[model samples]
Target chain A: MMGLHKKDLNLLLIVMVLALFAPFILNPFPTDSALAQFNAGYPDLMQRFVIFGIFAVGFNILFGLTGYLSFGHAAFLGIGSYSCVWMFKLLSYNVVPGILLSVVMAGIFSVAIGFISLRRSGIYFSILTLAFAQMSFAIAYSVLSNPAFNLTNGETGLQVYASDPQWLQSASAPNAPHLFGLPMRATETLTVGGWDFQFNVGYYMCAIIMILAFYLSIRIFRSPFGLMLRAVKSNQQRMIYTGLNTKPYTLAAFIISGMYAGLAGGLLSAMDPLAGAERMQWTASGEVVLMTILGGAGTLIGPVLGAGFIKYFENIFSKINDNILHQWFSALPDGLEDFLITIVHPFIGKGWHLTLGLMFMMVVIFLPGGLVEGGQRIGAMFKRKPKDTNGGLSAPATPAE
Target chain B: MGILEVKNVNKRFGGLQALGDVNLDIQENTVHAIIGPNGAGKSTLLNCLIGKLEPDTGSVTFDGQPVLGLKPHQINQLGISRVFQTPEIFSDLSVLENVLIPCFAKRDGSFRMNAIGTVGNETDVMSTAEKMLDDVNMLDKKDVLSGALSRGDKRRLEMAMCLVQEPKLLLLDEPTAGMARADTNNTIELLKEIKASRDITMVIIEHDMHVVFSLAQRITVLAQGRPLVEDTPEKIKGHPKVKEAYLGETAA
Candidate 1:
């Protein structure tokens, strides 16, 4: 285990290889089948997996490493999306401008929020972020409402037209310009025997950016700054007494996380060509928090795994209905079929959230380390010898214990 | 000139007066110990000097500059470091990583936004951190999680962290407060070794008279919120006021 954690160089290599080949493994299901909803190989969903993965990864830098939980990260994401759309309207439809603006705007916003929020730590910090998020949501809904649509288009959201100028138009020459000139064309199609794969070019773009974000995050996690962050998390008073300033380090982390959220938001608008104030809602921010917690807080791969897990289950579970349940029950015995349907009905359709809530609760209660620990436990069980099984590998070795 | 001078510092918290007209001057390259009973405001005074708390009155100066209202890091940049009574350390970080933080702060000042450079590649910072860890005899446990260390080792790591900054003045609150008898002796020896090698001035707040006598060149005793006496360690040990304030009827 020491060797495994000591050399994180191999960890990124493994993740990169897996991400590169994920499309092939994920594309195995039939397009019309229920399993297809679980297929993250599709361009739209794949883009989401990577982009949201970036968002959660950034958030983990602040929440996971430093133990400072912010509930308003989605506001940064919304700022990114809106800025991207605005770029699409004023300048080129290229994603570069949008991404740049998103980062700048999010950084500015975070500085203001961090200055105030950082005055209080722990639960107060969390509350401050939540309050800020809610305030932004309300302002986006009211001031940017339709009657005076100066900022956002209110509930209608901001949309880009195909007639937008092509600054970096070469990227989208054959294809129509996406928000800020990002090419939305389906660029590649692979055929293997009787199977065909249609790849959206935008997904690859998102993937490349995600890889860059991952690299930067890895560097930050290993830096002296990262050590100070962990120090602040463990004991702020000790850090101060050590003659070190923790405020600036934490504020930097907060801003960096905000920029990641902005980038994710920019990508979202680029893919869909629309930005809504609803994206900045506290609930949306809470979703990423859930993703980070459910996956594993501090580990690198944990956030991505958590993002994919929540997105996949959300896509698959919400689509199921009473009719779908009845069809499955029809294959069973008459009496048992009705009973199974009754028991499973609430967990499908609109009740999908109930299932997710229960899963979140169970994970938090039983596996506080999240899915990362869950995977480790399974690996330990298989590797344990019969005689050593009673002591289980998960049990920490220590003098005090 | 004295490295640190506190002139008539007074601190009040609601109805309580933590420090009442406290005054002290610490010369360069000497150990000054503050011995007091509980609630004598030693910790409060330390906090005030380090900028964790601001005294209602009086001023603090370090290296001939006033340091009354500066932030802790600002005071640190002016060459003062502190070690808390509790063994405060980054539990999740490796022992070496904890030490490297102060080295980075001292080298780069308060902030350096070099997001791309790997922390391990900073050879100077790493070497300095390693040297400090070696000084504290924690070089062997460099890769271990700091939280896993024994109490004595944790205190040693914190000292190494402070030392890496090369501060002119060091403030230690209860350096041997919770240590075993053997650990307490080890700490005193470590302090002596540090003093022999550097021109560092120290202010130690301790309860153990043996540790105090072994390390302090000068000792100041406090009762209530005021300083009762200040003298050489030998005289302090024999002072009737100090004995009466601390040893009670048993010493008589």
Candidate 2:
């Protein structure tokens, strides 16, 4: 409907619906219920779900379409966050300027990084990106946060302090990060029986932006440029021989994805008004890769699903402490309960990374095309999931290959 | 005077003279065949023409313009298209997409940020690509992944990809290299049809004399990095140097 093919339109609609109604979809359990801890509807976690979804969606444009994996994508995200926080410090907590600057700054940095990194492809490209990300992390963590010129504020992170010159901020305007007059932290709680559903302004803002980002990605996936990106991934030799330049195409995709990552980073600080050097850490970069791969790297909706999946595990699974585990297994015999907790202990709570790692391995090994392929398989089992009418052809193929 | 001129092009690899003082004149609207035994510098000469390799000395020009330092894509943008020896079609793409890429490249320059418009919306380009596929007898298989196609189909798809661009010069490097007899005959017929249907110049490099005789109007036989003979296909059939270039290798 939105200049997309019917199939893409349907996919976009599904994502929009899911994002818009995420609070209800995520909060199935009542507040008093034993499963309430699993509820991911809280604004903090919900905002993260969409923000990282934007990040992975953008990452997929580079890694998924052109098959250029940048191991240091989080540098752009960190740049976005820092730019956003700088806006809050200098201007106001209005968020519009911060987000815009974040995207621009990320684009500029990506042009520099991508220009150099794209010189080599395959594992070399990946290693180059990794090196750049590490350097950026080091610079942001220590160099930029020096006492004489405190930008990132070292490990303390950059936040909107009251003493900071917020020249654009009005006396009546909300002091916290906000859109116009609406505070990002503003929330409405709907109580029904033992269920409490949160409707947070910040989460909605992120959700709306994520939906737009997703729509743009869909348009890109359907476009001629998207086809060329796929062609670049398939056979660069053929592309060059066919009179198509590969450099500008790859560079554009890199910058575009960088801007997307920056937008995501800007959203991160817009919600909390805190910019940490840790956001640029290699692990954060790896997390987006995990999200893209775990969900399905190239698929239109796969990255978002992967982002939500990993964030859910990171937040909800990590919250399951020893007491929560003991309470769940209390009905069992004392010895057996203790044994179960011991076995499960290393895979949950503080060790939730173990569970995530196992799940990632299973996805890679079993569903090599990621979760999207798994969905397509199930859809095919019922009937040949009507093949995508246009550029969505990348879905049915094995992504790992 | 011809459309493409190669003048004293010399390319050396350490002690080996890959292509030494190679000279050729390829005319427009003709199928010119370049036949040589292995390591006779036929591929090297072709590489020089396509910008894959730069000759150490001398100039290669297409349509009176110097093409010596141009990039591969730049060479292509100047209306020179090459079909590789091993059918280098986009394996992951559909047959239609394989042709569509060159069409986009032909219409748009070397680099275009056409990120906003849908490919499906490009009705003119789509029709052109489909027409090329139809000419190659691959319209029915346009949706089929180019990788999964039979050898003959891949060859034809590659042909479609090149022909869709409608380049002034089409370079074919061993177009029927490893094909079975039936597939070879089909490719020959396809080439004949393509030649008859358009105002295109084709320069084919081949070891197969049957293909060389069937399609080439003019022939150039090379031996030891130099052109031994340039004649019509009939005269080339009985040329003594051409015989020595082929039969001498076996006798030695």
* Candidate achieving the largest lDDT: 2
Q: What lDDT is reached at residue A1 by model 1?
A: 29
Q: Please give, for residues B139-239, the per-residue lDDT of candidate 1 as tens digits.
A: 87787778777888888898888888888999998998878899999899889989999889999999888988898998888877899999999898778
Residues B1-252, candidate 2, lDDT per residue (tens digit)?
A: 899999999999999998878889999899999999999999999999999998999998899999999999999999999999999988988888888899999999899999999988999999999988887777877776778777888888888899889899999999999988899999999999999988999999999999999999999998889888999998988877788888895653
Supply the global lDDT for candidate 2: 0.92
Cα lDDT of model 2 by residue, A85-142, tens digit = 9999999989999999999999999999999999999999999999999999999999
* Candidate 2 docking classification: medium
TM-scores for all predictions? 0.91, 0.97
Worst 10 residues of 1 chain B by lDDT: B111-120
Task: Note the Cα lDDT for every prediction shown.
Answer: 0.81, 0.92
Model 1, residue A18: C-alpha shift (Å): 3.7
